[model samples]
Target: MRDRFTPLLAAWLRLLEPACVRCRLPADSGLCPACVDALRAFPLPAAAADDPAPVRAGLCWSPACAPLLRRYKFHGDLAAGAALARLVLPELRQAARPELLIPVPLHPARLRRRGHDQALELARLWGRELGLPVAAEALRRVFDSRPQTRLSAAQRRRNLQGAFVARAGLPSSIALVDDVLSTGSTVRAAAAALRTAGVDGIQVWVLARAPGRPTARLGSGHEQVLHEHATEQSGTHRLIGFEGTKAVGGMA
Candidate 1:
């Protein structure tokens, strides 16, 4: 049976190649202890303080989180995706008892290029672990939008508008899963689409969030700085301190 073969294959893979799933560092834990700790170190905060949604995130987005996600998404590293999702599961467990799990949908073009949807994979794995139902068809991306990484929060919001729509007959309560949350634009847009379809309650789940990351600016000289922050390409925009604890008055 395929199920029986899975364990045997896993054992063979382990015997033949024993290394951390992401970086390939020597380890039995799938990821090195140091990398595991580093990935797990980021705090998971409520979406908001007083009116927080029934949501939970595993870690904060940083250089480490980005690289792992990029490797899995761009490099076809299924092992790393599973390992990262495993790390994300503990916090996700706190969102217990959802009626269904909906991974954020990707546009057909991106999905075709990547050959897999990382969020859906994570959601399916998480659902299996929690004895919950995974509904990949409940939501769909109706429109393709620009990448959010380069846009400001406002621009990101604009880009994501009308990007998602929930299919008919989805349960009223459910959890939306994704790999990361930058400015919350995509999630919010997806949530809005779900609400429009009569979904009563929605919870957004992401593996990592960029805490206190500034929102998109309207225009003027400030726009350039905002773009730079959002871009924050390698060798730039390192996290110097906690939100509001350092420069930019907590605007990330």
Candidate 2:
């Protein structure tokens, strides 16, 4: 009799659990197992051949992930952000270890509006998990330029000109952390600022890489390896079935 009632008790408990934020299904954790696997299977971005600083991203940006990221970035959903940070840990561990982690700073005005710094939060989460130090104030966004999401590639580069300034006393090697990578403008600008301050060996780590048009110029032979890997995994997005769901509202 006890064994027969165990199944019923488990079903009742599941009904009482909170729903998954991504799929709205019964899940005690913010994300269900299926959603987690789907996100893990997302493709990695093709390495940018032009950028000198090597880039490593946990997953490629797509419609399935846009809502989840928007919720964390725009709506102050710390839970969602924590989930993303957890997902990116494996990629971070496999990359070249850095002495410190520096989060791309937001302009003061933008920080005031958003109420929290998503990049900083992610850096903190990773630092605790990886036992690495984070220098949140090493880099500052001096210029409050327009958002890059709406700008053309050229405009994005122009907007970030002199946008970042790094202070002295930084470590020789560090990884710059951010939520997403689009045209690579933001990290490029940030890396330039770090280089100017005499810091050497910079790497970029982001949660997702937004799909962009192919570039004409290419880097070394390593670019071909990354491109081929990305191409093979390009179809992985089809495994995620969240495309038809209602959009989660947030700024890109």
Candidate 3:
């Protein structure tokens, strides 16, 4: 072996423990202040829903803010998750203000594959920050469905129909937590299940909200595979490969 690459290898090893998640700057936390500021500016306009409860999201999904979610969602990056929570919690604390936080449930299979429910993690983080209680078992994903990418709003709704079931002991008023609110189908289905279970008044508190509709309606069969790949590198997932992200129906 030669010494030609020693300096580069040393520099990479030194940079392994970066100070900032996005900018690679010197900082005490996962994200530096500059990156945080940039992220703050990506909040989308609040959207209205026709469910039993209203839905609110903290940030708009953009290149700057969207990719950060993959780190928290699939790579087991709790610090990244915390940074994302810091962004969404303030909005929910001020807006939804529900005393109970209900993380959207994952299907048992998906839960096993992903190793964690991103929504549950977010709910716990928000609960701690807002001094609220998190009821992660309030709802359940009764069945699994196809990956949500490339589906239309109608198809998304159809895919999740009868998929979620809310349990008893859920509070009368609470907010449902999810990582990304895409088309809103998942939350709607979750909310409907809760309502059917006699729980009243639901709100959606999600971290990122995709800004507009997908460019095309072409159905791609790579949704689940892409998710697995995203988890492998933490930076490879793009607009179509959101892991904890939801789909094409009306979002909360």
TM-score, every prediction: 0.74, 0.76, 0.76
Please state the error at residue 106 of candidate 3 in Å. 0.9
How far residue 250's Cα lies from its native spot in candidate 1, in Å, is 40
Report the poorest 10 consecutive residues by lDDT, candidate 2.
Answer: 234-243
Computed on alpha carbons, the lDDT of every model, listed in order, comes to 0.66, 0.73, 0.68
RMSD of each: 12.4, 10.2, 8.0
Worst 10 residues of 3 by lDDT: 243-252
lDDT of 2 at 161: 93
For candidate 1, write residues 131-173 as lDDT tens digits.
8899998889987675565666678778877888888888888
- Tell me the deviation in Å of residue 26 in model 2: 3.8
Clashes of 1: 2
lDDT of 2 by residue, 21-94 (tens): 68878665567899888886756767878764888888777555666776666656666777677777888899
Residue 73 of model 2 has an lDDT of 68
lDDT of 3 by residue, 88-134 (tens): 66677678577688888877776666655678878887777778998
The regions of model 1 sitting more than 4 angstroms off are 1-15, 49-52, 214-252
Q: Is candidate 1 or candidate 2 better by TM-score?
A: 2
* Superposition-based RMSD of candidate 1 using all C-alpha atoms, in angstroms: 12.4
Ranking by lDDT: 2, 3, 1
- What TM-score does candidate 3 reach? 0.76
